[model samples]
Target chain A: MASEIVVDKLVKRFGHATAVDAISFSVDQRETVGLLGPNGAGKTTTMRILAGLSPADGGTVQLAGLDARTQGREVRRLLGVVTQQDGLDVEISVRENLTVYGYLCGLSRQASATRADAVLTFFGLEGRANDEVDALSGGMKRRLAIARAWMTRPRIIILDEPSTGLDPHSRARVWENLAELKAGGVTVLMSTHYMEEAAVLCDRVAIMDRGRILALGPPRALIAEHAGRGAIEIRCDEAQRDAVRAALTAIAVPWREMGAVFSLPDEGADLGPVATLAGVQVHHRPAHLEDVFLRLTGKELVDD
Target chain B: MTEFRLRSVAGVVERHRVATVRTWKVALTWFLIEPAFVLVAMGSGVGQLVVEIPGHGPYSHFVTPGIIIGMVMFHALFDSAWGVFNRIQQGAFETQLTAPVTVTELAAGEALWGGIRGVISTLAIGGLAILLGWFPLSALPVTLLVSFVVGVQFGVVGLCSASASPSMSALTLVFTVMATPLFFFSGSFFPLEVLPDWVEPLAWIAPLTPGVHLARGLAEHSLDLSHALCALYLVAFTLLLFPVAARMLRARLVK
Candidate 1:
């Protein structure tokens, strides 16, 4: 499949601080790519640059085969961008929000109305069509935002943290809507902090930190390569933590600590010796993207 | 298939129109009521105290044109400054940018919308003036044209301020520092000749001065070289400020 989006050596700087630094990636047509990162990891910056909302300091972005820098109008016509901020016109009705945006995107009145109704129905917002956006629930507002994005029937949809603040149920509903879009073969590029969201929705995940992509591949492949087969998590008291570490080290097993929990790969590790350590509770689970993400981006707290 | 072409300015105008429709009663009330108060207080009350000048007619007649022009200035300033500021801060412009609209187009559209508001306010005041027999029916078109130019000029100026303003309070500071002085010094309430020598020069340099002169000349049917020169000045100022506003807003928004 031809690539729907291609970003090469993308760089963005805010005064003296670099926001996005020489990041490169691509998404095939209809492929959902998740930009997985901590806060201030440049995910939103990269999405903004791709959407032509902000200019890249260095590097090029090609959207649907058009140069984003030079052909921004044409590029924008093919893209539906949902920023991290809720960009809904609050005074307008949910239906009017979509319809007006449709008009802005060059849809004829009839066509815009039709598309608005379709997307409203698709997002399960048909019942609230006349309701003001400010009156809607947070999840409904998010769905409306996404529905507005889809109003243009864009070839590529760029969502910046689409479910950042929603409750789990709302997030699940949003995910279902996105899953339906993916089923319809719409190309999606979303930035997310939820490891499970990326795991469930993304065909490929790019782990980014400190303005650069540290790793990129399918979620399962990344997990398998970075996290090994499984992990044994041990929570232990502060005093016994040293003893448990020494015991694990003596057993020659690779391990890492995050707060009270210590994680070790489950490959031929002798758990009997480590389990006997004082004040330690051990639980085993299959390796996943969270492990891979921590392995790539590290467990350091990102300030913003 | 339905044709899809980029109509950035039209889109902005449409958005404004939708918003205005919902709030037009309040807008129309202010547009009509405020000017009535200003005209009654300054035109009738102030006119009673001052004798007529040699060239200009009654003080009421002389100040009516300035009041009309001042209406444009005030509307344009508030529309572009507070209006643009709210849209930018609320992420409305960001949403618009997601479409095929460029920042330049957005600025132009907003300026044009401000001009539309100015035209609406001018029509309201002009219609009242014609009914009261203070303004001739013949001068309506020219006065409106001048009002529109003034609108676009100050609209662009206001948008430029809005682009640089850091917060709502910063916008308030702009109104207080920049607009208030222009309002008082633009000869809307009194002639510039009454001011001190140094202050008269500052009044001449104020953006609203040329607009006042042109609007007054058109309303009074007193066409002259100075009136033509004032028109030229307003046109030049508008042309210069349009691109400046667009570039400044683009820099603020697209960065």
Candidate 2:
């Protein structure tokens, strides 16, 4: 894979507040990379700067070999963005919206109409093309937004939580579409908080917290590297709780205490301990990416 | 394949036109119906109270030129303020920021389009006045051109004001405080011939005062040529505001 994006030392400030404290990252061609972080973690700000929706105070961003500052038009031309919020026109029909976006990207009248029809069909919106965008359902709208982004035939596509605020069915469909995009050789970069979604979909993931990348690698590799053996959830009464903690610690297991639920991790290293804890009400489970993510970036909530 | 840079001004204008044209009933209501109401109400109620100028003819003669000037201000200010504010607040501005369109292009296109819409309404009112048998309606080409320029001048001012202000309410407040006063004090409704000298200085700065002067000049040759140079004053004011407004819009956006 080749690097499709290069962002180095990006900074942005609003008044006195540093929105994106100097940060850097890149995504490769034909790779589906995930940017995972909590809400207000500066993920959207970073993407916005990359998309040229806002200027970075200091940084260099090259997309498809075009420097964002010098060749912003070419940078914009090569990349497509599906913003966190749907930027659709409620007053226009679905087809018209697609055509307008296509036209804005320099598509000719005939080409725009044809592409709009194709995108509408691709997104399962062929029959609804003439209907107002406001009349579309949540899933339909999300699908439309994604489709609109596709009208440009971009080499690199950035999705900002493409499935945010969607119901289960809508989320599943969106994920499936994203998976299809990845399969078709389109480089996909996204920021999301859905732990399971990242684990299942991302070719590689970068776990971000407070504007910094804490951990990066394949999900299972991260789990195997940091989580030790797979995680084991145990429920013990007060009388035997100390014994379990002591036993786990004596064996050099890493654990997190959250109220009464204890999470002990061994991260795909050995299975002997699972057998030992089996009769002790310990349910040994395979360590998930969520486990790796939570381990690297502690689960404590930031100041709310 | 699509290009990386979007031609956003052309794109947005094309998009706006498509959307606006689709909603013809609503647009007509905006472009026609409401303006008709104002013209009828104002023309009928106040049209009876005035006498003709010594050489210009009927009272309605003065009213057409003045109403045209007033409509120019009303349409220009209203369109730019509400239009730009809505786009900025609604995230449409973000699209333009990402596109190939520069701030200058977007602002110019918006001001131009707003002026066009203003001109349309002004003409509608002008036609209504003629049908009601007001002015003798002599010259065509020159009057229309001058009126068009007047609309553009005011439209630029409105665009600059809207882009510089933080909120739509502030735009409205500024209009009420500065614009409305200028409209009345400029001697549009009543001639300034008999007014006290103290109020003379204030009228000098009123844009519509220059606007009215030019309009009257175009309509009737009796209003004096040197006085119509006031319109040139408006032209200079518009020229100065263009770059200032573009810079403000650039800063306000792309944040």
Candidate 3:
């Protein structure tokens, strides 16, 4: 399949500090790729450059085979962007917001209205279509924001933190909407801190930090590579923590400390030695994208 | 590309139209009722004291055109400055930029909206003036055209100021410093000749001076070389400041 989005060595700088430092990635047609990182990791900056909201100091971004820097209008025509902030027209009704945005996307009066209704229905906002945006809940506003993006019928959609700051129920609803879009073969590029959101929604995940992508691959593949099949979590006190660490190091297994617990990458290594240690509680769980992210960034993915 | 640019501008204007329509009650109060109050309190009340001005027949008639054009300036200024500033704070500019709307096109749309609003206020206030027998119905078309052009000029000026203003308080400060002087110094209430000679020449420096000159000439049915020059000045002013305003807003937003 052809690449719908290609970012090559994209660089953006604010004065002397580089926000996006020579990062490169691509998303194939109909693929969903998530940029997973902590705050100040350049994900939002990179996405803004792609969406034509900001200029890049270096590198090229191509969307749907058009150069983003030179052919910005064409690139924008092909891509819909949802910034981290809810940019919906709060004074208008949900349906009016979508309709007005459709007009902005160059839809005709009739076509804009038609597409607005369809998008509202698709995003499950048809019920409150006439209600003013300020009257809607935060989750409803978010859904409306995403629905506005679909008004253009864009081939590729770039969303910055698509489901951030939502209740679990609302987040799940947003995920369901996005999943439905992904199922329909739309290419999606998103930045998110939620490991589960990335693992569940993205076809491939890029772990980013300090303006660089440390690892990029399918979520499961990244977990298997960075964190073996599963990891052994040993909860121990101060003395036992050192002993557990020394035991894992003695066996040549890599380990990381998480407060009172020591996480040892279980490469089928002899866990019997660590488990036999006194005054320590041990538990083993399957590897996950969080482990991969923590191992790559060397820091916990705390909420921003 | 030009066609698409036009479409983008139309979209933005349409959004503004819908928003304005939604709050038309407030718009009516600003455009119609406020002008009437100003005319009653300032025009008729003040006109009663002044037996006659030299050239103009009545004090009310002398200030009628000034008031109409002043409304245009006021609408253009407030809409482009405060309205665009509010939209920027609300993130609507970012939202529009994400679409196919270019920065220049967005600026054009905003400036054009200011002009349209100016025309609306012109019609509102001018219509009331006609109903009260203070303005001529025959001059409505020319007054509307002049108001639209002046609107666009003030719009660009407002946009530039808005781009530089860092906060709402700062913007209000700028407005108080800038617009208040123009409001009084521009011959809106009295002729510039009435000021001290040194101050009279300085009053001509304000942009609204030419607007008042042209509007007074038009309203009094006394067209002359100065009115024609004022028209040219307004157009030139709009053309010169528009790109500057667009560039400033682009710098502020695209950063």
Candidate 4:
């Protein structure tokens, strides 16, 4: 499939701090890609540039085959962007929100009303159609925000932290909605910090930090390449730390430290020497993107 | 060749309409109570102390037009400046800009809504004036037209102010410094000729002065070359400020 969104050598700067350093990536039509990173990791900045809400300091973005810079009006018509803030008019009804966006996209009065109803039903917001946005729970408001974006029938949607601040059930519902969108073949480029969300929802994931893509590929492939088959976690006392480090180095295995716990890639290596250390506990578990992120940055994924 | 989109402008207006309608009890109460209280208290209560004025027959007649124009300017300025500032802070325009709407359209829609609000205020206060026999029923059409012009004028001013204001307190300060002076000095409740010679020039230059003059002339059946000039002044002010307001909002919103 042709690339639906292509970003090349994108750079964004805010005074002395670079928000999005020179980076390049693309999302093909009907494919979902996630930009996974911690806070201030340039994900929102990148999504904003692609949505045409902010200017890029350098480089280019193409959405649905239209240049985001030169053909912004055309590009915007094919794009639906949900920023981190839901940005709903809390004073209005849930249905009115969708209709307003429909009209903004140049739908006729009758068409906008029809589309509003359609999207409300599709997003399971029809039951709350007449309710004021302020009266709804946080999850309903987020769903309405997405439904409003979908009202324009956009070919591609850009969401920044779509499921942030939601309970597990609400997050699952949002995920199911997104999965349906993907099933219907809408291209999606989303930014998220949740490892499980990216792992489950995205066809490919780009791990980013400090304005750079640290790694980009399928989730399983990235795990295999960076974290190996599993992770061996060893918790030891401060006194034995030096000896434990020496024992692991003598065996030549890659490892990362988090407080008293040392996590090493569970390659089938001899670990009897390290296991025999005094006052040390050892265990093993399946590898995940958290381990990959830790292995790549030597920093905890949830730190930032 | 034009970037202006009428549909987008209409969309924004519709949103504002829906918002106003949803809180119609509050709006209706404002429409009936605020203007009626101001007009009756100033027209009857204060008019008794003054009795009459030269060139215009009664104090009631002289002040009615002033009150109508004042109400129009007040509604337009409040809805555009303060309302726009609140919406910007809430990131409302960010959602609209993601669609096929342009910044120019958004500005135009806001100005148009301001005009609508001005018209509503005018009808309320002008209706009270007609019932009280302070204004002629024949002048309603021209009065509404003038109200719309003045509304557009102040709407642009409000947009410019909101775009430049850095914080809510800063916006309040701007309004206190700018709007309060304009309201008091624009010949709204009294003639500029009675003020000190130095203050007269300053009062005449207040942006609301032209709208007051034109509205008063139409309501009193005293239209002249000066009234035409007042209309021209209002039109020129709107034309000059509209693009500046749009550009300022674009700078703040699209960054």
| Per-residue lDDT value at A53 in model 3 | 87
Residues A27-70 of candidate 4 have per-residue lDDT tens digits of 99999999998898899999999988889999999887788987
- Return the top candidate by DockQ: 4
State residue B182's C-alpha deviation in candidate 3, in Å. 1.4
The candidates' DockQ values read: 0.64, 0.42, 0.71, 0.73
Which structure is stronger by TM-score: 1 or 4?
4
In model 4, where do residues sit more than 4 Å from their true spots? Answer: A235-279
Model 1 ranges with Cα > 4 A deviation: A236-277, A300-304, B1-6, B51-54
TM-score for chain A, candidates 1 onward in order: 0.90, 0.84, 0.89, 0.89
What local distance difference test score does each model get? 0.85, 0.73, 0.87, 0.87
lDDT of 1 by residue, A1-304 (tens): 8999999999999999999999999999999999998898999999999999898999999999999988888898988889888788875678888878888788887899998888999999999998878899999989988998899888999999999889999999999999999999899999998889999999999999989999999999998898877778999998888888788789876667777788766666678877887778999899887778666654632334
Per-residue C-alpha lDDT of model 3 across residues B1-255, encoded as one tens digit per residue: 333368788988999898888889988899999888998777789989985678888888878888888888888888789988877888878999988888889889888988898899989998988887888898888888888888888888888888888899888964688777787789988888899988987888688888888878878889988788888878888899898998999998887
Worst 10 residues of 1 chain A by lDDT: A295-304
Q: Which regions of candidate 3 fall more than 4 Å away from where they truly are?
A: A234-280, B1-4
Model 3 lDDT at residue B190? 88
**lDDT per residue, candidate 2, A54-148, as tens digits?**
78898788888888877767787777788777777776788988888788778887899999998888788999989988898888888888888
RMSD of each: 3.3, 4.7, 2.9, 2.8
Compute the DockQ of candidate 4.
Answer: 0.73
lDDT of 2: 0.73
| Model 4 TM-score on a 0 to 1 scale | 0.93
Q: Candidate 3, residues A170-237: lDDT per residue as tens digits? A: 99999999999889889999999999999989999999998999999999889889987777788987
In candidate 1, position B251 carries an lDDT of 81
- Backbone clashes for every candidate come to 0, 12, 0, 0
